[model samples]
Target chain A: MKKRITEPVKKPAVWIGFGVLFTLVTPWYFPAGSWSPLFWGIPYWALIIIAVSLALSIFITWVVLCQWDTGADETEDER
Target chain B: MNMELAFGGWSGILVLGLYGGLMLAVGLFAFLRHRGVRESLDEYYLGGRGLGAMVLFFTFFATQYSGNTVVGYPPTAYRLGYQYLVSVPFFIMIIMVYLFFAPRLYSLGRRFSLLTPVDWIDLRFRSKRVSVLAAILMLYGLGNYLLEQFVAIGQGVSGLTGGTIPYQVGVIFFIVIMVAYSWLGGMRSVAYTDTIQGLALLFGVFTLLIGSLIYLGGLPSAAATMAANAPQKLGAPTGTALTTWFCLLVLVGIGAAIYPHAFQRIFSARSERTLKRSFIRMAYMPFLTAGVVFMVGIIGISAFPDLTTAQSEQLVGMLANALANQNAFFYWAMVLLFGGVIAAIVSTADSVLLTFSSIISHDLYGRYVAPDASEYRKILVGKLVGVAAVVVLVLIAWYPPGTLYQIFVLKFEVLIQTAPALILGLYWRRLNTQAVFVGMLAGTILAAAFTFAGYRPLGVFSGLWGLSLNLLLCVGGSLLFGASPAQRERAEEIIAFPPSAAAARAV
Candidate 1:
């Protein structure tokens, strides 16, 4: 039986999209209230930022694992 | 927030001694094992470019995060409040920037057997002036970086010892051990020790967090305290603060991504698979390292309110002291935390020192001063000069000119100037060599000028101002004196390697 091979497509947009959403867009929306609804001891807006930052990291790991291929000419060595 | 009350007595000395002894042992072991390869720069500088996934991951981790993540970052978090949450994302942005150039650079490294970042500049442009300028820029940045680590080591040691040991003694003790190890094993010892140090840092940081939360009441209590006092810190950033946040994201992201040591790690991966796996792991590190430390900082704001700016810098020590007073277990944990912070700083300093030596030995001396010199001689020259540099840096660290934050920005501003030549040079075939040199020179001057002038134009960082000028010159100059037909064709051919080939080079 023959195996199938698929090329990994570079999806920089995935990283860029997340980068923009988290860094550019999210900062604008942080709650203006200094004392606000708290989520698990964090202010609501701060919690949201942390949550999105978490997502960004996860997304980056996924992209790194799936999107990059350094080509076939290079060979692994134990030196 | 009394730093001098953080640690004292025999326990601190015992821990510091154990950590130092362990580092020395690792260095000696690496030296004995890899002595055969000592004559060659490749073995000394890059550990023969054969690092596996775990070692590569941890070494990169230890080098990038550094002591600052533990000691310096918390204060920023305490001062800026939620505004400092930008630290977490900015680290993530570094990995993104890596995605832009590292893949190709890795492939090129294997094809040409590139040993240093400046080696890549030499390969691409084949211009002596361009390579030397980039080398000087990297060396300056590494010097500043090493100085920061030296200063941190002194502060961490003295603070942990409750001023039992003088700051000068603390700095000298670690510098001696660090330089000894680096001189012995080069990259091998550095990477091996980095694995141990990185784990120590992780364990210590998490333990500190648990101890903090357990003793100082959990996040909810801290949040309530913060809400009652220092409300501005909790409020969202507005106007200039927001702009500065964006600028930090870009400047730190690009500046850190292109660090000479970081670039060399790309060249040192055992395989493309190893490189990719390592990066995947690094992506999550911000949360575990920077993100966790940021929370620790936020907790300090409520736990010890009303600290002046200088006192705020002692947030870690203050918290550790309070925790140590609670129980035996907390005391031991705080000891480990301080020990780990010192180890982390040493690990970072060793990496920088290795890169610093390599640039002087290979790029400046071997390439220019004495091209006919043997490999062993070049290695010797690099080592001697490295020791000398450490001596000078120690003096500066002993009598630091400015605050830690100022020294921190000094390195990044100059280092980021090299980004255009390196990052754009990877893909843009027509990037003129002369243009790269001019841009780097102009950018570096403007950056230094703006910084000294204390001109941060409209709340923007001085580095960004210089970078803007640098980018303009690079793009404009490239057009003005366009690449010759031969240069264009050569660049196209060099860059046209299939991505898979680049990946497979290490397979």
Candidate 2:
């Protein structure tokens, strides 16, 4: 089987998703109300950001893996 | 500085010593194994350009996310509030910038055996002066960058350890290990240790988050405290702050993507596919590392509000103190966190040192100074220079004239100047060698001027202002002079390789 080399696409949805991820990681959406939920003093928004950030990592890993497979297959076919 | 309280007493020392020893062992092992065949420059400098995905990813990760991500970023978030969340995406956007150039660069690197950015310049422009100047600029930027990491190591170690080791001792200890390893394994040692260090850093951060959340009352309580006390930190960037965020997005996006060490990794990839895949994944790391630190800083705003810059800089230190007082589990977590901080710093330094030496070995001494020099001689020169660089950098760190952040940006300003020659030479057929040379020089000067002048163009970084001017000159000058028929043909040939290859690969 010939290997494939995947060319990068300028996908609008991917770009938009990136923009959303950027915005989400920022602290812009924290509401004005504060209910004290003390888990030894760490904050809810902080934890939420960390969780979201971790999810972002997993998502990135998925995306990169897809790019790798496609690109590798394409490149090998060229050879 | 809480010298007595900082080290976590015996545990901290043991951890630091163990980590340092491991790094040294990696370095020495690489040196001894590869030293016999030092004649092979590719093997010595780039690990024969055969890194797998995991090593490449972790090495790249360490290059971008460092101890600075841990110790410095939180205080930035604490001070700027939620507005500084710009740091996260700015990092992500750097990978986005990579998408524009890295694939093509990788293809070209393989074609010409390009080891440094200067090699690319040599191929593209075929101008001796242009290649030489780019090499010098890279060396300067990389040297200062490595120095910045050294300084951070000192500050991060003492700060995280609550001053147990003091700045000088901490900086020396890690830098020595970094130099030893880089001299031995070159890129291989750096990448291997980066994997270990990156893991330690991740573990440290997650533990801190878990502990901080349990101790602090979670984000809701922290947000309540922030909103009640100082809402501005959590508020959106407005006026100067908003402009600054936009500025940060552009400056860091371009500047960091163009960092010399980063470009080296682009060359180090096993294949174009590996490079592209790594970058795609890199885009999301900000959330994991920077976002985590930013959160810790935000919580600190409430937990220990009203601390000075120096005090806030020691936010992790103060938290560790408080955490230790809480329980044994918290104490161990704090210890791990400090170790992570040091590990991150060392990882960054080792990578920087590796690239710094490669530039000297491959570009300066190897290319112009002595094209016929054996790989052993080249590696030896690079290593000696690297060790000397560390020594001088340690002294400067002991007396860092300005704020660490200022010195940090100064390094980027110089590094970012190469963007025109690097990114533009890829797509622009009419890019003149003279234009590239002038544009890079002009861009660098303007960046420095803007930085030194403290001229924030509408709250954006001076470097961005310089880059804008640089790009204008490059594009405009290229049009005026135009590409020679030969230049145009060469560019067409290079650019045409990919799509055709992709088509061929697809078929």
Candidate 3:
């Protein structure tokens, strides 16, 4: 008989890393002058930030779908 | 203060009445269906752990967004300019924070049949002092949060009705409806009504945005106006403003994720898949909701320039009022928007009130005050006490102090103190109970002291200062006191679950 082995997912780092990159690190890389260029009324820099935020959202969906497992036939234990 | 309605008079009154009646019908339906199963705390507080993806998703939406997103966020954006773009990303950070602990916490909830966050604390630490202190902290945070909703209800009604309805009347009217529904069906009524209210708010907001663009001109025009009038508002943020933005992202992300109401929603999920699906949907909500509202606020900078801070608080209502006077279609939409604002506030209040009573019933009364009490007796006491709490909060709302932002800070400052213990305890086995207690106490005292003293060191929020100390103590005290080998083993067992389960299989 062969035994089946499953490895735990390590995608939480992707979420944390992307979250930091979009919110904290990326904003500093843009120069103050870069905000002057407008795309459809939104500043270019602001549009970039919104795009990063959208990516973060999509990343979260992927992590939740691929990474979490609730456990099997769990009986309720009284605390 | 003088009140002005967006589409005041009979239309606002009619819409409010219809919305109220619909909520009542939903509550009655839930009550009748749940009558047989209402004896247990799980059924009443957690909806028998049977919420599907849609109901769970909407309830989480309503609780997290609230009336603040509609009424309060605009003024901050008006003041901060493009800097307020931080709001959208900060909301996304909240879902990410949940990823750190929600999976393990959900599994723990199933394993121990947990009812409240305090229950998990009591189970993990096995310390009466720790549990009682945590419950008190949660109660204080929740009470303040509920108080904010009451104030928002009164403001939204008076502002939207053009003074046709007095602030006091507005507060009383919605409070009665919210408490009635929650009392009748508990979590079931709250979650179902949340779905309705959430849809109304989403529709109302998008319509308002479209109307604003069409009437006041589009974003390109608005940006042009700002460039000519207030170029600073469109420029990139640097210096202290940029630093504050970073603090907000971290603080609000962690603080909101560990909110007691939000924590309970994790347990309310029917299955691990349901919980995950709901969260996955929730991740994208910031773009639709907060992102849109942020654009509206920025557009206001061009639409109504030179307004003072106090006047800017009325940005949404003023814009709605202008649009209502444009055409019949916008007239009805503005009415719906204002009514939805009030409903959003009520929906948030009901969720907070439900979680508040659950804490009192399950953690305080059932666990400490009357250990042998039946579920019925405990729930009865919780309901009565909850009503009494509403009465006290209503009185405070009648005489609101400071601005909405100040009251907002007060709640988050206190609530975030729980994060170090709640989030860290999930992964770290050697966290000493005494360390947690000391850290919480020091954090609470420091947060309150800093806030009262009007101290903002380097423009960073007072909550972050308290959290810094809290995390320091939790980490330092645990190292100094240390857990026993047996305690470490017990923690390992509590946090572990079979990877084959639907929730852990992915992890």
Candidate 4:
């Protein structure tokens, strides 16, 4: 059985998605010092950044599970 | 920050002693379980490459979130306010950066039985100059890093015991214990202790947050306090602060993911599946550790308003004190929290020391000085040298080097210079070895000079500035001159090995 080999570096979509998420995680796109309309006692912008960070984590999980396959472990099993 | 907990005294000393004893016991356990730990570099340094998912995850956790994360990050959050929320995502960014290289790095590590990051460098470049230069740079950075942990451990110990155990005594006590365990079982001891330290750190931070919320106030109250007086703390970062936020994310993301100790843990995993699972678990840990501590700092704002910058350094200690005074349970818990803080520092120091010795045993002495020496001899030399380094670093930490302190601060800057060679060499076949040597040298020189001069153009860090130049030279020189055909084919044979071979192995 030929393992479905994948590397995260080879996937353009993965990079593009990460690029977007990384941008969102930085809070540079938010209005400077404009943290009004707080929710759950968190500044609105802080909340947004936290949510994006969560999304980044979830995206990382997806990439690790789906996009990382090198058959190294299957080879180890063979050994 | 010089800090002392209110509940620090005999109980603190007692807990510290117990934690040290527990670590030694763990080391003994690892030694008894694996009698051949000292017989091979692979068994000693990489735990024979058989670490399960949970141990790998905890070791990674221990690397990222250390005693500093518990005792250091809260004060930072207290000062920076919502702007410091960047700490949460910055840690997550580490995992994000890992995704770009670790998948392939893990496979290569397994294929080649790579023991240290320098091993990978030597394997790829096959140039003594490049490999030795990388090795020296790693050793220097790791030495400074261990020095830092030693200082933290001393301060943590003294502060927790309220000077019952003097700073020098506390540092020496832990150093002896740390070296003993690390000598006994090698990476196995370090990883097992890290699991324990990681748990203790988590427990410490969560209890502090819970105690603060229960006794002091919540985010809503803290927000109101910020609104009334320090609205800037409640606002999103702008201008220079925004630049700092962005710089931290990038520097920490790449620098930390490639930390020599953290990078080496990749080769220790039992299998690629275990490594992947550990990383997936690590991706979300910042929320539980960094995120919780960050909240505790914000809550401190409401509890102790109008604290000066110097006074704010004692914020966590003060908060723990207030909680301890309220109830007996919190009093004991606070003592354990301080003890945990000290243990966490030792854990981080142990990992750095382990990696430091491995580079000595595997890369420097074993490979060059005595290629025919027994594994036992190599391990012995590495241990003795590592202990000598500790003694020197302890002296430096105690009687401070009065000048040229910026040279010691070259830890991250110097380590990151190796990133281009380590990460790029994995993929780019045409990467010139001469260019790698020149780039790493120039990058370290530029970073150290800029840092010594306190020069960060455009609010960007000196390390990133050095990295930018290093990347330019690495890429430009490769595209212009490229590697020799033989080197290119070697790279291909190592990295681009055929999938058909892998498929055959799977069968």
The candidate that achieves the highest TM-score relative to the unseen native structure: 4
For candidate 1 chain B, which ten residues in a row score worst on lDDT?
A: B497-506
Task: Name the better of 1 and 4 by TM-score.
Answer: 4
* Cα lDDT tens digits for candidate 3, B1-507: 233874787788888889989999998999999894469899999999989999999999987898789777877887777888889988888888888788878877887889999999988888888889899989999999998888888877877777778889988898888888887888999999999999999998899889888877777877888788777677777777777878888888898898999999999998877888899989999888887888788878778888998899888888888899999999999899888888888898999999999999999999999989999888988888999999988877776556653544478899899888787788788998889999998998898888978998989888899999988999999999888888877776675445234245334
Q: What value of lDDT does candidate 2 attain over all alpha carbons? A: 0.73
List the candidate 2 regions with Cα displacement exceeding 4 Å.
A1-6, A9-79, B1-7, B29-37, B159-166, B400-409, B499-507
lDDT of 3 at B30: 94
Span of 10 residues, lowest total lDDT, candidate 3 chain B = B497-506
The 0-to-1 C-alpha lDDT of every candidate, in the order given, reads: 0.83, 0.73, 0.83, 0.90
Angstrom error at residue B24, model 1:
0.8
- Better structure of 2 and 4 per lDDT: 4
- Report the number of the highest-DockQ candidate: 4
The i-RMS of every model, in angstroms, reads: 3.0, 5.1, 2.8, 1.0
- Write one digit per residue (lDDT tens) for candidate 1, span A1-79: 5222212234556646665655642477664545477788777777777777777767767666666665522343323
TM-score of chain B of 1: 0.95
What pairs collide in candidate 4? none
Candidate 2: clashing residue pairs, number: 31
B1-507: candidate 1 lDDT, tens digit per residue: 226655565688889989999999999999999985568899999999889999999988877888789988999998888788889888887887888788778878987899999998888888989998999889989998998888888877887787888788888999889888887888999999999999989988998899888887767776777777867777777778888888888888898899999988888888888988898888878889998999899888778888999989888888888998998988998899888888999998899999999999899999999999988899999999988998988887666566544544488889999999888898787898888899999999999888877898888888888899999999999988889888887676666556344346535
